[model samples]
Target: MVLQRLLLALINRAQLVERLAESKAIRRAAQLTAFAVIKGRLAGKQASARLRDSDTARMMREEARRMPQSAADAAQTVSRIRNTFMKEVKEGMREANRQIKDRK
Candidate 1:
């Protein structure tokens, strides 16, 4: 008996819904709601795209600034290594000279 009442109520509600659907005002409201949803989605997409573009630009700029500094650092490291090697060669030459003089 309870199930029968619920089914009857749903049938009545469905009939009322059909009648309401035929009204121009209801149709207009639905169209407006759809447009609002579409507009909101479009705005969100545009903002997300802009944020991605800005982030890419910032990253490119940072890379550009780092290039020269990294090159300079590499050059400085090479110069230090060369200086150390030359000093070692000179010290070895002096030790060799001392040994030769003592042998003579």
Candidate 2:
């Protein structure tokens, strides 16, 4: 699956970043990968809510709290949160990777 490959890439690149700290492209790709993962998580939650069960409404309501203001803001909210998380994680990992390479 795509998720599996993304995880593999992240793990694989962690080592590459460890040794050489690959070009900015690799970092960008990793950030995008993180975004994709977060987007997938949100989508999965939405999908599960769609499969109505006893707690479907409650789950949807809970998810809505994390979402943005208007109905028109839904997609934008998801995109923003995912991107924010990706950026934050990428920055943290980059720092960690730099430390790792420095230690080498």
Candidate 3:
């Protein structure tokens, strides 16, 4: 739920940025946001792996069961997450652009 809210906020911000900024800047911001999410997930995985005996580790292990099982699957999952965010950003920008055009 929190992730969804964050993504929605990013989409709104991206829309606003698209109206007032260059394509490169908008792309950079989206990429940075995606990178942060991926980095945080990876950090959690690493920490959970290190703490194998704790209750938190047990929960993490259960959560890990829902994740991809192989390297290719993991890559695809991450790519999908990135693409989803990019799609939302593009959609927001398109909607904002359309609104601006309609007002003219």
Candidate 4:
């Protein structure tokens, strides 16, 4: 009877260990999934930023071609354009962040 009790105890311990390992695997999977999601979001954000930057650069170049002859006037125009572009980019990033958070 004692030997039988020992065997039963060992079986229970083995089952507990298995359960623990399974839980760990589940947790790891969840973590990996979260990482993947965040990574994807970051990649998307980077892509959008790149596209926006390219568009802004093109617009700036076009504006520069039409800029006034005076250095001060040209500088002011470029600064204004840059400020507007940056403001739009910031708003876009905020919106993206909100969407990402909502997804989570």
Question: Which candidate leads in TM-score?
Answer: 1
Candidate 2 matches the true fold with a TM-score of 0.33
Question: lDDT of each structure?
Answer: 0.73, 0.70, 0.72, 0.83
Would you estimate the TM-scores of all the predictions? 0.44, 0.33, 0.35, 0.42
Model 1 TM-score?
0.44
lDDT by residue (8-98, candidate 3, tens digit) is 8877886665775667777798899999999999989976674564444454465467777899977876676566556656775897899
Candidates sorted on lDDT, descending: 4, 1, 3, 2
Weakest ten-residue segment in model 4 by summed lDDT: 50-59
Candidate 3 Cα errors over 4 Å, as ranges: 1-65
Q: How far is candidate 4 from the true structure (C-alpha RMSD, Å)?
A: 10.5
**Which residues of candidate 1, in runs, are more than 4 Å off?**
1-12, 55-57, 60-104
For model 4, residues 1-104, the per-residue Cα lDDT tens digits are 99999878876897776786679787798799999999999999998787767657667887868958799987888788788789778987999999999999
What C-alpha lDDT, on a 0 to 100 scale, does residue 5 get in candidate 4? 100
Separate clash counts for every candidate: 0, 0, 0, 0
Clashing residue pairs, backbone N/CA/C < 3 A, model 4: none
Candidate 1 per-residue C-alpha lDDT over 37-75 given as tens digits, one digit per residue, 9 for 90 to 100? 999999899867755655344544554565545777767
RMSD of each: 27.8, 18.6, 22.0, 10.5
Judged by lDDT relative to the true structure, which candidate is superior, 3 or 4?
4
lDDT of 1 at 101: 100
Among these predictions, the greatest lDDT belongs to: 4
